[model samples]
Target chain A: AQSVTQPDIHITVSEGASLELRCNYSYGATPYLFWYVQSPGQGLQLLLKYFSGDTLVQGIKGFEAEFKRSQSSFNLRKPSVHWSDAAEYFCAVRDNYGGSQGNLIFGKGTKLSVKP
Target chain B: EAGVTQFPSHSVIEKGQTVTLRCDPISGHDNLYWYRRVMGKEIKFLLHFVKESKQDESGMPNNRFLAERTGGTYSTLKVQPAELEDSGVYFCASSRIAGGETQYFGPGTRLLVL
Candidate 1:
């Protein structure tokens, strides 16, 4: 079974500080990875995805993630954190079966708190 | 373009009652998906529909849940004899058929079974 683990349940950071959220996955083979953000009272928004290519993938809202095959990790990072960036972040891996798309398996998510 | 939308932002019903949640995907999106998030748990997949066909329902919890995309445009998930453990936020998402891997999500329907 494929599963995702987001170690940080909650993270607090000062505004303008760099941010990094850890994510690890357990899968049989190379899988598609994604990052999503849920703002306060907002719908789930896609941040970025990695199917197969370069390790580093850039996403919307000035976010980026690096996929490390050896460590089975795809960590989300940002150079600076904003007060508005306080939200719930989820890490997920797509169930890829023979090049076809499958449902996404999400981690427990990490709630980010920005101290302004 | 309008994003996916779910009706009745919040619904509270007594246990053993029946409740139906509706989802209207983006116009022309062929892939519609259902997901649920129980309190303090990760959001999990319930099912997926491709043009009125059940593409994948492996994630559906049990027989009490039934999802149908009759016209392939909108979907309804009905839970009969709802249980208190079924309370959660149900989310609906949709994407285009061709090369549309990214699924857009709706605001979600928050259900509470008392």
Candidate 2:
């Protein structure tokens, strides 16, 4: 079974501070990873995805995530996060057993709070 | 291009009542998925519909949960005799094709059972 674990339940960072949200996934085959963000009272928005090639993937709104095979981790990072970047972050792994399916297993998510 | 849209942004109903959640996928999307987040936990996949056919429904919790996609464009999930445990935010998402693509999500229907 493929599962995702986001260690941080909540993270507080000051404006303009660097941010890193940890995500670890457990899978047997070549894993496809994704990071999504959800604002309060809003639907989730795709931030970035790592299907193949580049380990460091860039996403919208200055967000990026690195996929580390050895660590089994896909960590999301931002050099300098703006206050507007505050939101809930989720990491998902696509199940490939059936071939190109939409069965995404997601993490519990990490709530990010930005302070001034 | 319009994104995936779900009807009834919020619904509050009593236990034993029935609630049907609707999801309208993107204009030409062939795959529609349903997921739910309960008690602030991870968003879990409920089912997936490829056109009017159910592609995968392994994640559905129980028999009380019935999902249907009549016209292959819009889908509905009906919970008969809804329980308190069914209270959560149900999210609907859709992708353009069969591959592992980016799925656009709806605002989600927050179901409160009291």
Candidate 3:
């Protein structure tokens, strides 16, 4: 019954610009959050993950995300994006169902377009 | 280390035809998962396997789809009597542990059911 929502369908930003992709999730317990990126014809790559720890989590390629429990949001941010950052980004949540097997629920994804 | 690998990067078949997709997980991974994405939908979980046992298959849409992991190393997902609605990209991922673990994905198999 866990679900994730990504408000933006497409985001266009110029190179070197700061970027933020919004993500919200609904789950019963403390959630496991993750961010992934997928380039054309490539598999999904993990950007970052949030379990139980500091609110801010740093990821590869200079990307970061802050988990806000009050708002039920885990938004991805980058100080400066490069042209190669253009790709589809997905926000996912895993429910803590007290089981060893837990599947991830993903949002529809936000397609990032880095403009020159 | 090499990441997960899937066989037959793409497949095109007519409606009612049968298609099978294969996935070879990371060398030491024990947990493997299958997911699919329609043209514009989020990736949906199809099943999960721990070694050779199916831990969770609740996400499987129907009986027409079958997934098996033999010897706990690689997996295969077969869809019989494929429908147009089955056209999508099927992705396979693997993790070292069962729960709360990071999963690495393989390049998906694009299946088109005409």
Best by lDDT: 3
Please give, for residues B44-104, the per-residue lDDT of candidate 3 as tens digits: 9999999999998888999999999989999999999899999999999999986679999
Task: Give the Cα error of residue A12 in candidate 3, in Å.
Answer: 0.5
Candidate 1: where are CA atoms >4 Å away?
A97-101, B98-100
lDDT tens digits, residues B1-114, model 2? 888899899999999999999999999998999999998789999999999999988889999999999989899999998999999999999998765788889999999999
* lDDT value, candidate 1, whole model: 0.91
Task: Please write out the lDDT profile of model 2 over residues A10-66, one tens digit for every residue.
Answer: 999999999999999999867989999999999999999999999999999999999
Instruction: Give me the TM-scores of chain B across the candidates.
Output: 0.96, 0.97, 0.98
- Give the i-RMS of model 3 in Å: 1.6
Docking class of 2: medium
Q: What are the TM-scores, per candidate, against the unseen true structure?
A: 0.95, 0.98, 0.97
DockQ, in order, for the candidates? 0.58, 0.71, 0.75
Q: Model 3: chain B TM-score vs. truth?
A: 0.98
CA error at residue B13 for candidate 1, angstroms: 1.0
| Candidate ranking (lDDT, best to worst) | 3, 2, 1
Q: If you score just chain A, what TM-score does every candidate get?
A: 0.94, 0.96, 0.95
What lDDT would candidate 3 get against the real structure?
Answer: 0.94
DockQ of prediction 2: 0.71
